[model samples]
Target chain A: MRVSLSTLRILVLLGVFIATVLFFASQIDGYMNARLFNRISGSVAVIALIAVGQAFVVLTRNIDLSIGSVVGCTAYFTGGILMAWPDLPPVLVPVLAMAIGAAFGAFNGFLVARFRLPSIIVTLATLAIFRSILVQSSDGSSITTDRLPAWLTEFATMNAFTVGDLQVRWIVVISLLVVLTAHVFLTRFRAGRTFYAIGSNPDAAAFAGLNAARTIFLAFVISGALAGLAGFLFLSRFGNITVVAGLGLELKSVGAVVVGGVNIFGGSGNVLGVLIGAALIDLIDTSLVRWALVSEFWREAVLGLLILLAVAADTVLMRRLLRRKGGAA
Target chain B: MTWMRSWEGFLFLVLVLIYALNAWTSPVFLTVGNQINMVQLSVEKIIVALVMTFVIINGEIDLSVASVMGLAACAFGWMVQAGVPGGWAIVIALGIGLACGAFNALFIVGFGIPSLVVTLATMIAFRGFARVLVEDRGISGFPDWFNALGQRGLVGPVPLAIIMFAVLAVLAFLILQRTAFGRKVYFIGANRAVAEYSGLDVRSVKIRIFIASGTVSALAGIMFAARVGAIRGDIAQGFELDIITMVLLGGVSIFGGAGTMSGTILAILIVLALRNGMALQNITGHIQTGVLGVLLILSVMVPIIRETGSRLLARVR
Candidate 1:
């Protein structure tokens, strides 16, 4: 008599996506422009990069609150390196950035894996510590470039291709790649499904001898490394890095991960959902500015509302499914 | 008793040592005036940390405390400006805090979600609400009586707010040490289902801890307003992390089942002393934050290293 819970959850989210798109569509009387698209997509790319990495951690039922700091550390180091050697290749920056991030991520995983400490606490301690290092290292000065290598900024804009009078940025292309790769890794790869299995039931996964430590450690490394890649792009796009740069990102990325329907308790949710969640959050920011009727102070309120609505929807969906299954029983 | 069992005593010794060091190094540090100032500044956050001890000990977190404090401060100040009696305003202020914590608990308990993500969302969401409530501007001009909160002291230079915080801390220490509810809290935090099977009223205990945390935060909110006599959306900036650092450094396990208020108070003093010492030494604010970060990592590392060392000894023995 009613829609199944999983389907209903998707349908509700799709409905929200559609409704927001339509509402925004109504405002598309040429006011929607390239600069706006660039700004929104730019913001989405940074958050997506972190969220995708966080997705890996969350898949293992562990979380890394240090992603924002990882981004900061990597970006600052990237800036320092590139500024000293401006002529050095663009590809090299990403490589260094990823390595630094992976080292930290591996440390996180090691603490959880070797010491068997909780990921939340270990990451929490590192979050402040890393941010502190960034603050001290910079001494409040931003690491910036007067100009980036051409390829560095290429990800920000697409290949001048037109689709129905709208141009998607190259970052959008990257976003698709990131999301696709994430989806495949989670769904198809041996390591990917292992993450789901571990998160779903850690004890059983351990009993199955899946090397929970390696899987979790790798997840954190991927999360941290990807955060580094994101950091490189962040510097390239924003052209600035300071003490507060990438500040408050961990929470926002967590918000994105949580909103995307990845259970905080872990075990469920997909990257596709998170990608959509990321876009929706971006759209919300744009739409709020577009509406112009309400006070701008409502930004946090609306975000809180979205988180609540998602949790509420999740509860209702779960209850409905439980009721159906129990009734059959 | 095991060390963890008598952690309170060990913690008190550390507190004494810290105070002694402060007294020895800075001639002005132990002076009644400076001590009062230290107490006045740290009370609100200390109170919040006090209740947070219970929440975290119960295997939950309330990241919304800062936001609740922000919203409460905004509401309390705005109401007083609108001609609400200060006493009645205090009541409403506490109510707003309870409401905010309860709102967070709504999803936490109602949806069986982890408090971390829920509170983080609300941290943004509620801070956003506060921002909207008082759009980027701070409100001031409280009655002169409000200023009395910061200036007045009872019994030879102990600020009233500090005195009040001390009283609350002592009462909390007693309750946590001497009450069935306290034991139940530990039980539930250590293991929820077992406590439930023991008929310990886990839900009510949880809801009550949240209320206590909310009320403590609200009290701090008002006291902060009284102390500073100002209301702004951004008051207590980055305070949530600071309090958590104090709590964790105080030796409260994030996973719950262990921790003491005495340790929390000691940790707060260590942090306050560090901050005060850093400030007196002319360190910048950024550095102060960095020091706290350093302290957080070091305190965590020390115990870990201690355990590792002892374990190695045991194996060799």
Candidate 2:
């Protein structure tokens, strides 16, 4: 059996990720080691959820730059609602957030799919618009931990399991559930496979009787819904919601999706790959903190470099793969 | 009647209606002083938007423009504050701008990487580099003459920045309207494969456009630093959205191949007038930003809607 390029890339990244963590764990103190894993799991939880959803959209050869803003907007919506009515069940928070996110996503789909506007520009515009709405509604103030109901904050920090001394939070479990569900849908469902068909070649997909626009729209809507879910996780984990709650998240998710072996041009990748990609990004962040060699400012710069390297490698590898196939035929 | 069917005509009518509304609502809206001030505030964005017009027209985007502006300004501020001569600092800033543009071109034009992703990476990377340079601190104390030039006018009530922008806009207009290069840009944007088969240097044209965008953005940064009299790494952080908004609102298709400088100029004025009137009415900055976002969406949506409507009509006929 031929090992596909995406699977191979993920394997290599996973290997590098484990080796880096093991090497650093041996060199660092026990407290720092626990701290490193804690940060990785916690941060990766929210990012993985967002990245998984984003992978769907990117797999359709369209990008969503508005998810970060959607996250911020949805978090504020949930946060605002909880503050206004403390008796609201904690479960309702994520539901409301997902609904709001889906609405925004539908709007984006309407423009991109119905009208056929470029997705990037449509999302960029919405990013600004959604963020401004969040700001205006909040009156430029943050909903802090004090305002959050006790149960909501408790759920945020609830420990799911312990690995020796390192405790895993419930958010990690939820993130895993999201990933597994998405993985199954993408691998097992006809609707999920259509996304790849659309991304690979929309014209061909259309000719083959696939509803390309509908599939693309579904991908974006799913991405938006997941981002909204991540917002709730963010609220629980941080216990604070500001106008800038999820700033720069769009780039971070894109970075993870690309690094996770998803083609930037779309048509390939999986939820499991995004999980590892999200872990690698968070690991890099935590490692930089643990080593204390580089300033915190370098994190974004490093993420940028990682995105470039990931995309460049994918492009080169893909060309080589195609050439091999062509030669054989 | 035919002109009314065109995008520029629609923009002109909108501009007129907005101008009238402002005049009716605000007693000072008709004053030349306030109008000049409005232009001054948006001049930097306008200048960058013109170059962006070319980029979008050529079927690519430069998301790194705002970051390049921020980076160039930071570099200039660091140099001048460190006692480098202002003249030399300006040259160095332009050179940095050129290098930044070339970097984008290398990935996009050379490697065939999507310009959107390449520019997105540079946008973050370049902004990161700027933040590392200036951190949270703001640098000031530019040469007196330079500050005056950036903030004040050569002619009565005409800012040097605004004048420089006008000259550049005219030059861009000519290059885009009257030159063979401009036609080539449209050709490539309309169909890159066809342009390549027709013997056009598609890669080189794309490279040149990205470079132009970078350089113009850098220049805008210098003027911005002069206007503000300080430089911070986070300066112009979200300006890319506004520049792109203005260009698109001016009727430049986001997919490329159809737009004009006149339309962009008209759109910029409309935005300026709207923001200026809102400021006069004491509207919050957040609300103003929201309005621009709505305008951005509507700009693209209207065209799509019109085309769809027309297609439906034709099918029925």
Candidate 3:
């Protein structure tokens, strides 16, 4: 009958998310509809993938600030490849995008794992480096919808199934699969457990015979690959690929990971929470645009406030819970 | 041998080489006007970087510095547009900066939250506030005197900003190297638990450092407004990372407690020189930023690489 602290946190988050949605639904006329779900769900899919990747990195006690730039790089390159080889198989495009993303991730991993460089600094540098590479490669041109294949554009809205007025797209299904797969791996597998072990206490993990460096490196690689998959989804969702694509996604992904009840200090959190976190953020964002009282300028402010409150609440609640538990023990 | 072994010494040699390379490529590379122009263009970021060195060395970060800069500048512009006197607007902008810093300090010191997460939130919030104040609008047409403070030289061939930079750099060096407060900063950074155990007022010191970071960032924003003769929400949008890069490249340990003002000054100069040299050679700005990113990485890695190489050599011997 005992529930874990993480489980309690997740339940609280879910409650908050539902309450907010209800509040928005009551205020905005005609807010409870399939169109709103379709819009928020589509964008949530992209944010969820990156957030899941970021969750992996956070679980390893590190961060990948370059994921945004990695998304931009992979998205642009994938678009260019599809444009060049229009007759190529549709299945290979995402694979190619993931490969490109993995390469960028490997570069980050090498510096952080091999040199013991700080993850924040290393990824911060690579964020610029990767974006600059994209800028130089793109050379002022952008890949518009006209240049991309019809199948790719169609894939964005292609429905997996429908129930009444609600429709589920393939991208949403893909992102959910990725999240569920990551959730299982982190919870059920030993190799995946190493990430939490390293993050919680690196010195202890080392003493326990874990290869801390390799695990950290693997975390970065997985983050990179997920970002790449998100990039492919991005290209499909938005047929235009600009150099500035995915520019501020790093902030959004980090925000989602933290707001999802995942410990920012790294170690205890689940990808299911991240999925909810991403949904909550995207829901707020889309709702704000429709709300007449709040200006669009307040969107970033709201996101910032949410992150601050989430972190603060997590700290306060956890302290009280732990104190009570300590007394019982 | 000792000088060669030092990070600053190695940076000085790199600075000299870049100077030589620039001088050979562009005839105007060594001119006083071009040199002053180079310093003027980045004076705001360098000023903030000086304070940022303190923040980082104190074992924390202020990701919101750039956002504070933007907010301060926009606040000043908003006030001026509403017919506030030029002098009072400047003071209010700085006050706003102080408030911003105190806000960051409250979350970090009072709540015991991590500085990184707190500042990251503020970074977004502050920028959003700036955007709200001046949504897609650029405010300009400041008083001539204010513009002169940034655009015209106060001393012959030197503007007011450069003067402020010089004074602040000296003050920073003296305080960091010669004062007891500076020692406390290092001690706290090296090990906060030990410093607290030793009876140092860790919370007060941290609060002061963050407040200083906020106030300095605001001052830089004011300077930016004066220099550009305009203000917008996106002013200094991505300058935080660039400023941090300069400090980290100066050999300041990101983990805190170990860095010198002299190293930071050298790094500022090296970055300025590198950018100027590349600009003179007609390289694109993006490419220049990319090069600096590489430099940021190499700066941290070089010491480690050198240590490993030496270890390998010793093993062979």
Candidate 4:
């Protein structure tokens, strides 16, 4: 029955989200053609999947910079596999990519769990390592899937009710799947709740007899797996796989995760909030493009602005709440 | 024994071994002109890594240094475009870089924001700002005489940049070692809470380090502009990875609190020589990233591996 402050903030962001959607829709006729809209939404969908994975990592108050590289590795591997055997069912691409992604994730897990190395450093190193794999494997070229399997085409196409007022790519469907699943996992599942508790206060979690290292490792696994799925979706949407395909993605995912009200210090956010954050970031980028900021640099500026606003808002609200309760943070 | 266990010691071994190998493989490896060229190229990165040593030591990372250089380089371009004297342009660019660096410090310190978060934001913003200023057009066209910073020598075979590098490195070394503030930074980075409890001004210390990082990165930017005689947004793109790799390779811990200027200098040389040697031997650019990636991985892995192995033996016993 209680509307918590965070819940209220989420509601406000949703409302802002709707308004931004309308603003873009109105400009749809003039600037964003159906083709452009489809492209933008599709890329956003792909990015959102990765962002959700990143949100999970950040949820435990850790980070994984290797998501972009994971995406690159997965996408490249999937694309490369498909290229090698064109007749093989494209449906298996996700499974194959997910397996590769899981391996990378497990390695990240091993480094963090066994060594107690900081997540950022471990992930950063792997970002380079995984990306280099794609580069070396591809020999500085891209592998394009010949054609989408029929089922994949069905999964990839996005539209309003499929009748076609506004064409939404199938990426939107997958993004929702990732988001909803993550949301349920974070809020309802035991491991998910444990992750939050661990992130909020690792020592407290340990004192409560939680296996902090294992939980962190699991978090990384989930993050990597989701990134792998996002990579599949990336290939399903963009046929070409380049060495730099997911380059700079880690930072963007961090931006979306943090901006969505996820605490950088770990714990205290949910997937639903992250989805909203991801949508908002996508909306901002699209709107900027519609406004004719053809120079791609402004995109970075917008991202920085969003990160600052979100962090400032989260920190201020949290501090105020603590102050009002007359307690130390 | 401690010294031998240090980054300097490790890098020294790498350098000696690499140098010996290069001499054995290629007679041109140890020539004075070629070696000076390597040092000359290393000047900017060495200086920036010196300051970054303090930044990482304070438990923060700044990804914006390369971007800061891009922007600072633009300051010079803007000067020349506005018809300022060449020397004036250089001075003004350096000043602007300092200001930008200080601004980064202010944002991080004033807002109590994490350095990673703040600099990440600024990295995009500054780069974007630089892009807008340049508007996809590069500014060159400086007086030939003004180009002497990159062109002329400092008494028989030395570059002005190299001299600048040594002086700056020593000053940075003193700051990080002799100065009380430097000591506080290392203490804070090693453990912020302990340092805070010990009455160190963690906030101020971190803010100053950010500024120092920004300043040095900007100086590097100016020199890069001067060296290549151009400035653009994507000019130094992807360079952060290179600098960070060099900084980390120099013995600076990624998690912070343990490195030295001497180590950074050795790292600077090793990176330069490796690249130069590779070039002489014709290694591809893409593979070089792989090399750096492997090196980056090994650096982190080796330390963690040792700790893990030692702990494992203890646990098993």
In order of listing, the candidates' clash counts read 2, 0, 0, 6
What is the C-alpha lDDT profile of model 1 across B236-270, one tens digit per residue? 75677778888877877777887777788888887
**Please, what are the lDDT tens digits per residue for candidate 1 over residues A236-265?**
777667777777778777777777888766
Error of 1 at B193 (Å): 1.5
Candidate 1 chain B, run of 10 with poorest lDDT: B1-10
In order of lDDT, best first, we have 3, 2, 1, 4
Residue pairs with backbone atoms closer than 3 Å in model 3 (clashes): none
The CAPRI-style docking tier of model 1 reads: medium
Query: Could you say which candidate leads in DockQ?
Result: 3
Tens-digit lDDT track for model 2 on A1-329? 99976577778988978887776666556635576677778889999999998999999999999999999988888888898999987777788888988888888887888877788888888888888888888887898999989988888678999989687999899899989998888889987788888888888999999997788788889988999999988888888888988999999999899889888887888779889989988887777655655566677678888888888878887889899999999
Tens digits of per-residue lDDT for model 3 on A179-237? 99999999999998998999989999999999999998888988899999999999999
RMSD of each: 3.0, 2.1, 1.5, 3.1
Local lDDT at B169 for model 2: 80
DockQ of candidate 1 against the true complex:
0.57
Model 1, total clashes: 2
Clashing pairs in 2: none
Between prediction 2 and prediction 3, the one with superior TM-score is 3
Whichever of 3 and 4 has more DockQ, that candidate is: 3
Off by over 4 Å in 2: A19-32, B308-317
- TM-score for all predictions? 0.92, 0.96, 0.98, 0.91
